[model samples]
Target chain A: MSQVNWRTINVDALDPDSALNFDMSTLTPAVTPVSASEVQGLAGQIRQLLRGGDHEGALRGALESVPYGADEKGKEIHLHTVIEILQSIRQSEMSPLLSRIYQSEGGSELLDVLMKYLYKGMSHTTPTGGAKQMAPQATGFSQIHPLRTGDGGGQAMSVFLSWHEKLVEIAGPGSIVRVMCDRRTV
Target chain B: MAQPEIHHLFHRPIADHSFSSDRQTLAVARDNLIEIYGKSGQKFALQDELRGHDKTVTGVDIAPNSGRIVTCSQDRNAYVWEPSSSGWKPTLVLLRINRAATCVRWCPSESKFAVGSGARVIAVCYFEEENDWWVSKHLKKPIRSTITSVAWHPNSVLLAAGSTDGHARVFSSFIKGVDERPAPSVWGERLPFNTVCGEYLNSTAGWVHGCEFSPSGDALAFVSHDSSITVVYPTGPDMEPKAVLSVATQLLPFMGLIWTSENEIIAAGYDCAAYRLRGDEQGWQLAGSVESAGRPGMDSHREESALNMFKQMDLKGKVQDDTKLKTVHQNTITTIRSYAGSPERVRQFSTSGVDGRVVIWSV
Candidate 1:
C-alpha cells in the first residue's frame, strides 16, 4: 500500500570514477522469489559452485530460482532470469564459466538441463522447440571444436566446446542456435 | 497490494505494443503483422490485422492526440496508420535506409516521429504537405552502430537516442518548417536540425538499452547493458554538465524505461518486473519494485503440505519448480510506457515482453 523509494545509491558507478569494491556477502541472496536486486549478486558464488563439481547445485543455483508469483507469466519471468544467466555464459564469461561446468562430473547433465530450459523458455507460449530449432539453425554461434579429455589441450574452451556439443545432442543436432539483441556485427 | 492486470496476447514473442488515446484499442507487433485488439467489457478482442511488412515487426506506437499508429519492422520499413471510417489506412514512410528499423515513437506534439534503426541512424519522419506523403531526414553523424531506442522531449523537437555504440545523445531535431523555433532551454539556443546537444556513455561502455527525457525535459536517464542506470543533468549545451550520476545495480541488464515524473522512473527489462527509481539532480536511488514477489496469494492459496510437495515431485520430477517467475511478465520486458498520466505525473504504466504478455501497473 505504501510506495518505497527504489533508487539504488551506489556512488561513482559511472565511468572514470573511483571503483567501489563492496563486499558481496554484505547483501544476502533471497531464497524466496527473486526481484531485480538478486540477479548478478550471486555470479561469484555460482561460479564457485560450478568449480566445486556441484553441477546440479550450480544448475539449481541458476534454474532453481523462484519467481515472485504463482501465475504462468510469473513462471516465465523466473525462467527468463535463468536464460539471462545462460546468455551471460555464452557471451561474456564462456571460457572460465563453461570450463568449470564441463570439467565437473555429470557436467553434461547440466548442459541437458540448460537445453531443456532453453526449449521451455522459448516454447513457453509457442509450440516451436524454441532453442531446439535455434541452436542448430543459428550459424553465427560458436562451433564445437573436437573435444579432448586428457591434459585438456589447447584453450580451456575445449571443455566448454564439448559441453556445447553435448547440448546439441540433447536439443537435437539441428536445434542449437543463438539469438542476439539488437546489434549488427555483419 | 494491488493486482496487476495482464493480457496474454498470443504464443509468439511480442516485439512491441501500443494503445490508442481512448484506451479502447490496442496494437501489438506479433511477427510480420500488427494485430489490433479492441476492448470489449473488460478483455481485449481481436479486431483486425495490418499486414505489410515482410519481416518481423519490431515496434508499434499510437500518438495520443493525433490517433495515428506508427510501426517499424526488421524489414527496414516504417508505416503510419491513420484510422478511417472503414478501418485503419496504412501510409508508407520514405525511410531511405538499408538495415532493420528497431524502434519508433511519436513526439508529444503529434507532428513527427523518430525511428531508430540498425543502420546506425535515427530517421526523423514528418509529413511533407507538398508531396502528400511522409518524409524522413536522417540523424547520421556520430552514431557508430545500431540505434537501439529513441525518445522525444516534451517540446517534440529535441530527440534522445541510445545506440549500440554505447552512447546516449541528445540532438536537436528542429526542422525549419515542421517545428517552431521556441525558447532555448539548457540544451541550447539557435538549435539547428542536427545540433548535437550532449553525449554520455556508461561506465563499461555497455550498449545503451533505453533512453528517456524527464517530464521537465531538463534531465536524461538511460539504462545500459552493464546493469547500470545513469542520469545526466546538463547545465548548458557546451559547458560541463552539472551532474552525471550512475547507479550500478546487482540485477540483470534493463531493456527499456520511462519517466513517470521528474523524480520517478519505472524500468523493466531482462528482470521482467518494473522497478522504481526515484531521485533528483542532487542524488538518486532505487526504491524497489512496483510488484511484490513470491508472497502474493500466500495465505489464500492451497497449503503446501507434505502431500502437495510429494505430488509435485511425482508429476514434474522436481519439488521446487523454476518454470514461473514471481513477476507478472514471463520474459524480457521489451517496452515500458506511461499508460495514464500527464507529462509531470504518471498514474499507471504498461509493459510488453517476450512472454507475449502486456501488463498495466498502477503507481
Candidate 2:
C-alpha cells in the first residue's frame, strides 16, 4: 500500500464551509503604518553607509527598521536598498560579519528578519505598477535593480540563496522556521 | 541515576502509548490497531488487540482511576474501550467532525474527554446517561488550523490545545450537566462551555506541537516547531500574563514535552534525545541532555588488539567508533508521558519513538 502524508492533506478541499477558511488579516498583529518618506529616508542613509564601505552599518540599518507597516512603494524602496547591501558584502566578510551580528543582543531576531526579507527578495518579481513612481534617481545607484526586472534576475536570486545558506549554517534551521511561521509580515 | 529500561516493542512506530494505573497493562497505538500488553516479569506480553479503526491511530489515553482506554484515529472516529468479562467492549463516540482527530485526553475527573481534530474543532465528549452513549459538544471559535495536541487542566474544566497555526489556546470545556461548578481561579470566575480563557503566541509563531498545564494548573507551557518551549503564567482574566519565558534551543524542534515539576521540563523530538529545561516564570534555559553522553550497554573495557586496530584503520580510515549516536533513541521521539509519580512531580517518565523502542528514564 502507498503511504500517505496525512498531516499535509488538504481536508478543506472536501468541505466547503470549513473552519480553515479563517481571516488571515486578523491573525497578524496590526502595525503603525509607515509613510513613504520614512522608508526613503532610511534607504538614503543605508546607501550612504554602503558607499563609505561600512557594509556592517548598512546591513544593520537595513534590517533594524524593517518596513513591516509600510505601503507598497515604501516596502519596494526598502527592499531595493536591502538587496543592494546584501550583494555589496564580500563573500569572505560574510561569515565574520554574520558572527558579529549573531552575537549582538537581539541578534537571532535580526537574523530572522533578514531571512524573511531574503525570501521576499527571491520571489519578488516586477511590481504591477510600472517605474512611473520611481523616486528621484540616485546618481551612482544602478538604474535597473536585478530583482525588479523580467530578465537577468538569476544573479539576484543566487545572491539571496547564498546568504540564506550562510544564515542557516550559523543560526540553524530555527531561523527559517521562524521566518516562515511569523505572522508579523515584512 | 538508574539506567533507563529499554523495551524494543516492534519495528513499527508507536504514535502514542498509555500505561494503566497499576502499570500492569500497556496500550500502544500500533499502526491501525490498539495493542494491549500485559506485563509478566520484566517484559510485556501481547495480551489483546483492539482492532476497529481503518486508519492510523493518532492518540490513546487510559483513565487512571477508571482503567478505560480512549483512542482516536485519523479516520475521524474515537472509541472508548471498557473492560468487561467477555472482552474489551468498544463504544463509538459521535464526534460529528469532518476531519481526522489528532489527539485526545481524559480529564482529571474522568467524566469527559476532549478530542482535537483537523476540522479545527475540539469535541469535548461526555457520556449522556439517558442515551447511554458518548456524545460531544464542539468548541468552535478562533482556531485557525489543525489541532496538534490537547491537555486537560488539573481542575478538568480548563482544556489546553496546541495547533499548527502557532497558537496554544486554553478553553473551558465545562459541560453543564456532566461537570460541577469549578471554583473561581485566575483563569476566570464563571466558567462556561467554549469560553477561551487564554491564547498565547510565541515570538516566532512556530506551529505548536505539544502543550500542557503546569502541575498546579496555574501556568501553561507549549513546544513549537521553532525549537523553542514557552511557559506562560496568567496574571488574571482579561489581564496580561505575568510572564512568558521562551527558551529557544539549537536542537531540532521538540515533538512532545512534559513538565516533571514546577521548574523542570523534559522535552524530546527529532533530536532523538530528551533534554532537560530548568527555569520558572522568572527565567528559563536549556539545562542539558537528560541522558549522559555515554551510550548504555556498551563494553567500555573491550580490548583492542593490535591487529584489530590496524584492520579498523584500514577499512574505515579511522580507529574511533563513530557509527552510533551518543543518545539511546536512534530516531525521533514522538511522545513522552509521565510514567511514574504524580503530574505534580514526576520521578520517572517513559518515551516512545519512531525507532520502535520505549525507554523509561528516571528524573
Candidate 3:
C-alpha cells in the first residue's frame, strides 16, 4: 500500500474556505486556525488514501493528526470530524467530497483511518481539560479559551501553531496565511 | 390510505367526566355535584351532591376492580366516594392540603390510588377492608413538590408524578417481607432530570407544565413552558433520556399531553389549538383548532346585552358577576383526556375549556 503524499494534499485542494462558512458561534471551546486546516486537509487525505488502497497508512495518518486548541470553532471542527468519520465508516461511504475514491477498493481502508484518528483524538483532547475547568468564571468566553490545567497543557497550543505552519508550508504561505488571518474576524 | 372509522358511542354537554377502569361508566363532576353516566350517556339517576367540598371538583378517578371513586377539589380535600343504592356519597375526606387537587388516578392493579395536589405532594392511599374507605399510608416524605399530574405504571408497581417544579418523579413499591429488606412505605424514591428534555428556551426561564407516561410504560412525554414537548425513556435503573424533540413557538404553557401510541404524542394548549407529533418529525403538526361555543363569559355577555335591549324589565337582581364570568376561560383549555376506551386510536379525544361544555372530536 502506498502512503499518502502529505505535501501534495494542498489546503486549497481541500477547500478550507467553503468548509469554514458554517456558523462557528455555537462551537464549544473554540478551535485554532492551524488545527482547523489540518483537520480539513486530513479529511481530504483520508479520502484519497482510502481510494488509493493505503488503509494502514490512512489510519496511521488520522491517528497522527490530532486536534490541539482551546477555541470553540476548533473544538467543533474536531467534533465534526469525529462524527463525519464515524458516520462514513458506519455507512461505508468515502469522505464527503471525493466520490471517485468511494468507488475504489481503498474505501474501507480510508474509513478505518478516519475511525482510528477520531477515537484517538477524542481521548487525547477531551473537552474536560480546557474551557470546562474555567467554565464557571469565564461564562461564554470559556468556550473560546479552553485551558488545560496540568503539565502537557501546552501540547495542544504548540500542535495548533505547527498545524497552521504545515498548511502554509504545503499550500503557499501567501494564500493560506491570508485565509487564516481572515477567519479571526469571522 | 383509508382513515380509521371512529364510532361515537355517546355525546353529552357534561363539563368534566372521568372514566372508570371498565370504561362502562363515567363519573362527571359538575358544579357542586358528581353524577355517574352509563355508556349510553344516560344519567345514572344516582345523583349525590358532595357538600363538604366547598369548591369545584377538579379531578376524579375510579379503582380498577373496586367500586370506589376518588375525587379532588379546589377546596383542598381528596374524598373517597362509594356507590350505594341511594346514590354516590363521600365516605372519607382527607383535609388540610396546601393547594387544590389537580389530578387523581388509581394504581393499575393495586388497592391503592394516587392524588396530585396543588401543594406538590403526592399522597398514596391504600384501601382497607376494615376501615371501609382508603386511608393514607403517610410515608415519611410526601412527593417533594407541587404535583400537577400523576400516572400509575401499567403493571401497578410504579407511579409517575409530574410536578410544578419541572421534574418527574417515579415512585415504586417494594415488597415488604420479600427478604431482610425493610417493609416498603408509602412515599417511594424520587428522580429528577438534569435538564428538561424537549424545551427550547425562548427567554431562558420556563418550567415543565405537564407530563404523562405512555400506555406501554416505555416512554414519558412531557410539555414545557416554552411550548415544546419532550419524550424520555424511564426503563433502566439510571433513567436515561433517549431523545429530545422541540416544537417551536406554536404551543404555550398550560397545555395537555397524551400518548396516541408508543411513539406518537398529542398535545393541546391555551391557544385553543391541538397538535399531533410523530417520533420522526422535528415538531408538532397542527391537528385541529376550535373555539369554545359555550364560553360562560360570552354567554353572560350576550345575556347582559339582551337584558339591556329589553329596557331592564322588572325582575329579580339576577345579574351575573361579570368579573367572575370573565375568570372562567382565563386559559383557553379547561380539561383533556384520551378517548375513554381506546388508547391507541388517534383521530378522536375529549376536551372541555372556558366554554364549560365538553366536546369530543374525531379526525
Best by TM-score: 2
TM-score of each: 0.67, 0.85, 0.49
DockQ of each: 0.02, 0.32, 0.01
Tens digits of per-residue lDDT, candidate 3, B69-138, equal 8887777777888777776667665544667777777776656677777654566666555756556543
lDDT of 3 at A153: 37
lDDT of 2 by residue, B31-69 (tens): 899999999999988999999999999999999999999
Please give the ranking of all candidate structures by lDDT, highest first, separated by commas.
Answer: 2, 1, 3
Of the two candidates 1 and 2, the one with more favorable TM-score, higher being better, is 2
| lDDT digits (tens) for residues A1-186 of candidate 1 | 247554664544652212243332212112244444444455456667766865446655764343332243444444554544444343344445544554565443344345445544433322122222323224222233343445323333333344455555443331222112211101
Best by DockQ: 2
After the best TM-score superposition of candidate 2, give how far the Cα of residue B360 lies from its true spot, in angstroms.
1.3
C-alpha lDDT values of all predictions: 0.73, 0.86, 0.49
Task: Report the C-alpha lDDT of model 2 over A18-59, residue by residue, as the tens digit.
Answer: 655657656555577899999999999999999999999999
- Residue B53 lDDT in model 3? 62
